[model samples]
Target: MSGIACAVGLLSSKCILSAQPQSAGRILLQYTAVRYRRKPRWLGTAKSKLFRVPERHQQVEEEVAELKRLHNVYHTQMKAVRRFLIDEVEASKLVSRAGMVIQTPEEEASEWEQIQRINEEWNRKIGEVREKRLADEREQRKNYILERLVAKEQRDQENRERVEERVRLEKELARNYITRDNIDKAIEMALVQPMSYNFSIDLSGNIRRLGEEQNQESSN
Candidate 1:
């Protein structure tokens, strides 16, 4: 086939494919041998086809008859619906006008007072709820602060107790501590005792001091 004919066929196939369900995966690729440039607006139609007449597309008789029937039915239904809506609107307006009553000055004042009372009742209810919510929030905040203060006091008490325990321990150990006045006495006691760290553990888990075992064996 010619390039132009192939292009037209491909374009028509693409249009048909686009209208089909997506499960069909058919694709058509268009190709052209020569690229044509568009004519400028200043250049009029070619003189060769200046007087040619275009042919009209013929319509089928069945399709024309069916289209005309559908159009007539649609127009008739739309007209009926429009008239029904217009009548309903006019009836509603009349009913409303008839039901409306002209109020006297005293009646109007009474209605206004009733509306004011209702507004005031609603305002008072809202105010009570707001105040209660604010009170609950304040109470929660106060409790939180009190709890923090109590926890801080407990922590301070624990710290003071720990300090007092350390001070008492230091005071108890002060009797053995080597100060300037007790340095000579502490040296003399250490020399007489001669402390030893050499010890042995037997299979029975009893500790035997090396110096004491040697002294006992020599005495025996």
Candidate 2:
């Protein structure tokens, strides 16, 4: 058979074998192409290829020498062209720089005056802002100090009132305190009362005089 006929027949058979059958309305798809994977390096050479020798292509010495000479000439020509282009670019830049206008002394002085004016204006504006900021900071500091003073005054007032109230209470209680002037009266009252402290406490936390109950029974 012809090559084209054989190839078409083989492709048809491969497609038929690889075709996937579809349901009701879906189109059928077939894969007829073959893919090859590279052998892993760790696997080494195959057993069947161990004795195989690959043929090497040989070149004529004269042809190889001619090719080497042509390569050298090409590299040298390229280097020369690159160097000429770089020199031409550098020369063009120098010519451009040289063609720039040179300023007159008067023009230079005018430019310097303009730059100074701009610098002076910037300094003036910066100074104004700095002075305003400093003023605001001073005002804030003054307010803070005023507030601290007010708070300190309030605290001092509160402390003074507390001390005065405590002193008034102590003075009121001092009226009843024992002193040398009242010692004789206090002793006379103690002797008239003849108070006794011989007592016992019961489980109910009541204090009972030891002889008071007996004295009461005898009087009855």
lDDT of each candidate versus the true structure? 0.83, 0.84
Q: What is the per-residue lDDT of model 1 for residues 1-220, given as tens digits with 9 covering 90 to 100?
A: 3455445545444221223334468655444443234433444555656798989999999999999999999999999999999999999999999999989999999999999999999999999999999999999999999999999999999999999999999999987789999889989999999877799898999889998799989999
lDDT of 2 at 128: 100
- Model 1 pairs whose backbones collide: none
Candidate 1 runs further than 4 Å off: 1-74, 102-110, 136-144, 211-220
Q: Report the lDDT tens digits of candidate 2 across residue range 1-220.
A: 3455445545545233355667886766665654224443544666667889999989999999999999999999999999999999999999999999999999999999999999999999999999999999999999999999999999999999999999999999999888999989889988999788899898999888979778979999
Model 2 scores a C-alpha lDDT of: 0.84
Residue 177, candidate 2: alpha-carbon lDDT: 84
Q: All candidates' TM-scores?
A: 0.53, 0.59
lDDT of 2 at 51: 85
